[model samples]
Target chain A: MIEKQINQKAWFMVLPVFLLVAFSAIIPLMTVVNYSVQDTFGNNQFFWVGMDWFRELIHSERFHDAFLRQIMFSGIILSIEIPLGIVIALAMPKEGWGVPVCLISMALPLLIPWNVVGTIWQIFGRVDIGLLGHSLAALGIDYNYTQEPIAAWLTIIAMDVWHWTSLVVLLSYAGLCSIPDAYYQAAKIDGASRLSVFRYIQLPKMQRVLLIAVLLRFMDSFMIYTEPFVITGGGPGNSTTFMSIDLVKMAIGQFDLGPAAAMSLIYFLVILLLCWIFYTIMSNVGEESSNGGV
Target chain B: MTFNWMAWTTPTATFFIVIFCMLVGMTIWEIKCPGGAPRQSILHFETTRGDRLFVSLLGSAYIHIIWLALFASLSLWWAFAIACVYALCVFRWV
Candidate 1:
């Protein structure tokens, strides 16, 4: 039986992290909450404006557009990255020196800062000086991300895929590595084809890691700001303006503190809700699969 | 176009110095209470010595420089595209 005692010892171990996260996260959150309910007049003077900003943000067309765009962007990123990661993981060698090489390569993109990823793509897609843009122009395709909305969207999507697909690959690879050799041997003895083996063995084995990849990618993509903001600045007429970008514009650009604060709270809650849903679904699937195996 | 060597030097130097200090601090702390290496399971592979080293050096360098450059440039999208190619090459070959 598990110990029922009040484990004060574990709290000691966790205290440092708890304190750090509270300082970094909770304090700012409280500040945002305070700002959400109060109006500022530039010189430290404030007035109570309960629910006014919240209502304004909720009714704003700009907010609606950005919110929709954010959802779409997150959805596209998840769909593309998750499947691509699984495929890459499958193609990678199960064992040998190639394993380390592949793993390192896959992890390289995730290591780069979000802004760097944006900058690299921005230069790379330039028509005159940039390699990709120059090459495409040479091929007679007029690909200008700065001037064209479709091209800008494509470039942003491609950039995201390039930067984050590695994460999915690494996670999926880990899931693949954990599958026992005995499973493969059993399948082989039964004369299972490659497709069947992958279907019955690899797919099921990878479910948990895939779940993690999905949830993480979804959350990160939803909150993405730096890369796209740097790359497109929310233009070709707000084509690539995700919610985070709009929030930043509101908070810092316009100094609409109350509305920005409310929006941030709403944004945080949206992410929290999505994360909870993802967790519940994943755990349910895990339980069902385990039960089926048993 | 002329390269901004002066512009580059300060940040790069600062980054290295900070990293060096961090390593020194961590080493001292580890000696006091040697903890087991944390195990993180990935789907297709386990973490190896070479993998960890490569990631630590390359990852930190890329993250720092890219983040800095993003704020420095007038046109960030162009820089982002180039970085993607660089990342792709690093992953594919490095």
Candidate 2:
């Protein structure tokens, strides 16, 4: 048994992050809350209109549609990126000079700024000048992201996958690399098949990183605005208008501050609730699996 | 017509070229001394040099993204400054 020194001075190191979060997150959040329950007109005049904007936003069909679209986009992205990332990670070279080569190349897309990604895709999908557009047209494919809703969705999804799959790959690769060589040597002694080895050893080792990857991907994709906004400007006719774009349009574009503020709160709560649920469930599953494996 | 290389703008070409050079450099470094052994850090899990780079780059991207989302009209220099700080922290701790 050892006695630990409890020093309150340790909290000093944490103070910076706390202060940063307060300024960046809490202050803005409080401002939004203040705006949400109030009405303002012209020269700094304001009136309390408690819950009116919240009621309006909840009853709005536009909010529901955008919310559903956001959900669908995240769902589709996860389904594609997770499996694709894992497969890429598995196929990647595990040793020698190839390891860094593979990792750096895979990470290239992720390092590009989001708006630049949007611009690249936008240019790459142009009908007259873009490579992809030209080739597809030459091949007799009716691919126009600006004209068709399905085309717009597909392009956005593809763009998201291209931009983000590297993140999942890197996380999965880290997880894979963490497994001790002894585990593989034992499996070899048992004459375990490749699939079985992956199933038992690699998959279990990957559980923690995969949880992190999924959560980060989910939150990022759910809040995604820049790329899609730059690409289609929420599309030809609100076909691809996600929640973030819609919120910005309402608040900044239309200056409906009250409604936008209320909507922001609702959106924030939904994401927070969903993330908590995902975290609890995944951690519980991880614990049970480890226990059972032991 | 043969491929028109000029269609690619300066920034786009430069981005890809830089990434290519970095990849080549990393490959040479790895070949000279293959080093991926995980070492203990401030974080609970062991991490290699490559992991540190990933964490730094990813965290910086997040900093920029958050700044862009919150303050769209402003120049990104402030975001870049903040991201630099974030990168330093990730390199030190994560």
Off by over 4 Å in 1: A1-7, B1-94
TM-scores for all predictions: 0.73, 0.75
Best by lDDT: 2
For candidate 1, the iRMS in Å is 19.5
Model 2 chain A is weakest, by summed lDDT over 10 consecutive residues, at A42-51
Residue A243 accuracy (lDDT) in model 2: 99
**For model 2, how does the per-residue alpha-carbon lDDT over A162-198 read when each residue is reduced to its tens digit?**
9999999999999999998999999999999999998
C-alpha lDDT values of all predictions: 0.77, 0.82
Measured against the true chain A, the candidates' chain A TM-scores are 0.95, 0.97
The clash count of every prediction, one per candidate, is: 29, 0
Backbone clash pairs for candidate 2 read: none
